[model samples]
Target: MKFDFHSHILPGIDDGAKDIEESVKLLDDMAADGVDLVVATPHFYCMNMRIDRYLRHRNAAYEKLRPYLKPEHPRIILGGEILFDHSLVGNDKLPYLTMQNTDFLLLEMPYAKLDDQIIRGVEAIVEDRQVKVIIAHIERYLAFTSYKSLCELMNLDVLGQINAESLAHFGTRRNCFKLIEDGYVHIMGTDMHRIERGYASLGKGMDIIRKKFGNDILEEFERNGKMVLKNYSYEQIVG
Candidate 1:
């Protein structure tokens, strides 16, 4: 079964799917595309969301949409697309968003260059031995002239996540393929947002995977997704 580990399917929170109707529609589309499970990863920017409030709203939204969920639709799981913040690392308030009880945390980086502070922040989290960090959408960090810096980060035991859409881009596809080939990337996610832009792009991404990598590669990607659902450690799967 296919699983989309990242999506903004949670309703009325942040920019994704303004209401339940849109959220349900996104689910239907995912189900039709063979996604058996989807993580309702709403944005969890530290600047905006308080931990208790985020959980309360997430639960309420899940409850409101429960009755409408079809048996054939993808199973919804709660998570958040957490933006990186230094305060989040030992803070008891934010641990719930870390891949559902597993040590792995989905960490989003800033769109620009990777700074020393970001590196140290991630190092602090890893050094604590409490969380194994997964750098969400590693492709965005390709602006660096040499991939040595990226390689250095990967050696820290941080897993990389690649967005499906990058596989189809001319400029980015080569690097994505290179990362996949080198085994640096351990997970694939849609990172889907709106139905119009996100859903359509995901479809194209699936096609790109199918055409370029064949079914076996796609199957392996799906297997990693299942591994996440089962809370498997990255060391167990990647090593």
Candidate 2:
């Protein structure tokens, strides 16, 4: 299945789609991109809002678009793109932020250097919180993080999600491919925020993947994504 694993299509919860109408439009565009399923990962920051409040708002926003959902459009899944914070370590409620009932959490890192604190925090989230972390938009961090540092984070038994937008770019594509080649990246997403981009670029990125890597890589992505949607524990699939 073609899963647009990261997106901000939820209405008004974060700086994604603005309202129900906009959310529907984004979904429609996703359908055109041949996306089979979508994980509406609105931004979640520990410092900015309480998890409970964010959950409430996320549900409310999804509910607004639930009625308008059509068969042609990709099915929507609820998930959180949490901004990584050390306070989240050992938090019992971490699973609630995972891909709805799944053990995988999409965690976004800050734009600064990816270093010891960030790496250790990811370790704590996995070892302490007991949730698998999929680093959101792993390609974007190349601007700030050294390649060796990225390998350290990936070595912590966490997965990486590459944004389709990153692959569609000429400059970023090489590093994105390098991540895939090194086996750090395991999944893909549009990270679709606005209607103007991401959606179409998803198709473009996948096309690029197909041409350069072939169908087998796409199958790996689909298999991993399927396991995720079925609520398979990361250990069950990876370990």
Candidate 3:
């Protein structure tokens, strides 16, 4: 499946799409760009908000946007870009924040330096809770980590997600390609906000990858995305 594993397309939720119209428009662009599914990852901060309260807000926005989505539009899946914090470890309600109510969690780290507690917390979430963590837009956090630290995180068996925007605008093309080629980037997302910025760039960025590598690279992303969905369903069945 051609899946956008990270996105802020939900209306009035965080810094992505503003209203129903924008949400619909973003979905339209996604379909046109050949995206088969969109994981609607609105931002969720673990600092002060209760999980129940956040779900109420997110569900309400999702309900409002639900009516606008066409059947032909890329399928929408419920998830969140959870800003990682130590407090979230072993929280029973954390499962509700996972993708498709499954074990795959879209975890995001802040732009500052990574501390030991955060690393241990992620490990606990995976080992204790049986969750597979996909680090959101990991390229943004490179400055906070040394190459050794990055290798350590990858060694933990966590998947790294890169944004199409980062591939196109953030770093050198060679470095970005190196990340994907070296198996660091398991998936790519537009992380689109509005039509003005990344709506068009998703296709453009994917095209860059295709041109540099080949169709096989794009197919690898499609296969990896399917594994996420498949694993989600498998977790549900075993439970």
Candidate 4:
């Protein structure tokens, strides 16, 4: 199935859709784009709020948009774009923060220097929390460190997610392709914040990959997406 691995479609919970109307529009557009499902990953900061309060706010936002979710629209899967923090290590709530019914946590690294300490913190979360960590929008951190550091981080069994919009420009597109060729990218996300900002780049980005790398390359991405949302078969997910 075509899965949008990351999104901020939840209403009023974070800096995403303002309310139910905007959320519906985002879902409908994603449906038109041939996206079968989308993970509604509003940002979750462990250091900023209590886990109970965050989940409560997140669930309530989902409920607000529930009535507008039609069968034709992309199905929503609850998840979070969690900021990595030392406090999250060994926290009992980490599992609850994973993608719904899956072990993958969409982890967003801090914008600071990408050092061994940060990498080790990520490693601890994996070894201790027992959840697969999907590094969110891996392309955004290019200025923070070198690809070698990222490859090293990848070696610890964490998957890397890239924003589909990263392929918008020539320089960025080459970097994206390099990541793909090097086998560093694990999944793609729209990172859709609002209609004004636009999220349609997902289809364009996939088309670029298909044109440059062929159908097999696109299929490889779909394959990884299937692996993440494996609880449901492709036949079972599509309406």
What's the CA RMSD for each of the models? 2.2, 1.4, 3.2, 4.0
Per-residue alpha-carbon lDDT of candidate 2 for residues 23-121, written as tens digits (9 for 90 to 100) = 889988888778888999999999998889999999998888899888899988899999988889888888889998688899998888998998998
Error of 3 at 189 (Å): 0.8
Best to worst by lDDT, what's the order?
Answer: 2, 4, 3, 1
| TM-score-sorted candidate list, best first | 2, 4, 3, 1
Candidate 4 local Cα displacement, residue 120, angstroms: 0.6
User: Relative to the unseen true structure, what is the Cα RMSD of model 1?
Assistant: 2.2
CA lDDT, every prediction?
Answer: 0.75, 0.86, 0.80, 0.83
For candidate 1, report its TM-score: 0.89
| Candidate 1 lDDT by residue in tens digits, 46-163 | 8787888887888788888888888988888787777888787677655676666565677887665566676777777777767667788787688753476677666676778888
RMSD to native, candidate 2: 1.4
Stretches of candidate 3 off by over 4 Å are 170-172, 232-239
Decide which is better by TM-score, 1 or 4.
4
Model with the higher lDDT, candidate 1 or 2: 2
- Mark the regions of model 2 whose C-alpha exceeds 4 Å error after superposition: 198-200
On TM-score, the leading prediction is 2
Question: Residue 86 in model 3: shift from native, Å?
Answer: 0.7
Clashes of 1: 0
